[model samples]
Target: MSYAIGSVSSQDLWTRLKEQFSTVSRTSIFQMKSNLQTIKKRSDNVSQYLQKIKEARDYLSAAMVHFADEDIVILALIGLPPEYNTFQCMIRGRENVISLKEFRSQLLAEERIVETHVPNPLLSAMVADHSSATKGSTSPFQNNSSPSSFFSGGNRQFNHTKQKGRGKFNQGVKFNRQS
Candidate 1:
């Protein structure tokens, strides 16, 4: 009876060690497979996000280009030619793009039109929930604070009576006034 019990115990230990060895040997391979799956899923998600971002940027840039042009954009916002017609900004070059910091000063120089308007009821409720997820913001338009500032100048003084066309001297851009 004692010999039978010893034999059974020895078999159990050997069986346990064999199972443990198998588990240990396979661990790194299984872990690598899991990690690869996770990495593939994350890569797919990032690709999707980047594609969406590119589309949005293309559309936004088209709109900004129309606005940046001397004639079409400023007129749409401020209203009428030959009055503010002479008041064009030289957005053609790359060098003079205004800083976001200076944007505050520029808008402040205008009226406080950059201040967020209360969104319509449907829009307002959406803003309320998502607003907490971000920093202190409540409007869709209030976050980036770009060309909105340019629209703030309410009562513009049209001192010059130039031609109702592109550039004060668009052809002779060199002579056109810059301040």
Candidate 2:
């Protein structure tokens, strides 16, 4: 390291250092801005995602480069996953820009709604199986057995016989007509 031989005032030395190292600050600011743009929510929860964004903003602030709250809000929305598309549209469509606090609150609420509404894979499979099984049945109550057999406790002794007909009521019935 080189040392100054003459006594240098602290202010003079600070000025000299900053003038020499100004490029470092510019590079730091550029990198931080790039990082902010590329951030993504991916697997992180709402809070974690917001925290990551706020940290990047904080770094920019430390480097004397500050973004407006609206800009920050836009950045946050841009980094959201596709599942939040509706929420992003809502925010973008607002007449007034939302504060960061309100944005955070709404985002968390939306996250809860999304979590609650997500279909369970197992439940979905069960429903799909049930619908496929019942596809051709005329009535929801119709199962493997004939209606009489189904209602009569599966007794095979019943005289009911299957017949081609317009409806269930006439399927196994006999009617006499008098002229």
Candidate 3:
């Protein structure tokens, strides 16, 4: 320890000591910022994800680097998985900025909604039936049978007759063609 201290000049020793004690290293700050930017909510719930973000923000704060609530909110939103797209959009489209507290509450509520959601059996069956019915056909209207056969019903033929002077505009018109 004495040798190490003696190697540094007295004039530079105080300055080095002050820098070490008073300042956060640039690399440490960069690492913390990177962590904040790339944080993901892959399998975590809303509360866990929010807690991670809060921890990162707190670390930055301890280093004397502070982020606005809006910035933190944005970071949190961006970290969310695709499942939260609608919720994320709702939060982003708000006219007024959302406070962190409000954001947390809203996220928890949304999480509960998502967790408690149940797929309707009838709806699921309908979807499955529709998909199976249309699996081999490119267009819904496409069929293996002929158009005439498909629409066969009632009368097979129609009688055509032209009437003269059927309307005010046709009063002066004459029908010369036979049907």
TM-score: which candidate is best? Answer: 3
- lDDT against the true structure, per candidate, is 0.38, 0.79, 0.78
Candidate 1 residue lDDT tens string, 65-152: 2123332222222322222223223222336555434432442333233234344798776676556534554443465643433233
lDDT of 3 by residue, 122-173 (tens): 9998777668756767433465544443244322433335555645445434
> Which residues of candidate 1, in runs, are more than 4 Å off?
1-105, 109-111, 128-179
Q: Residue 170's C-alpha lDDT in candidate 2?
A: 60
Ten-residue stretch with the least lDDT total in model 2: 1-10
Off by over 4 Å in 2: 1-23, 120-179
| Candidate 1 steric clashes | 0
User: Per-candidate TM vs. native?
Assistant: 0.15, 0.55, 0.57
Q: For model 1, name the residue pairs that clash.
A: none
User: Candidate 3 — which residues are off by over 4 angstroms?
Assistant: 1-23, 119-179
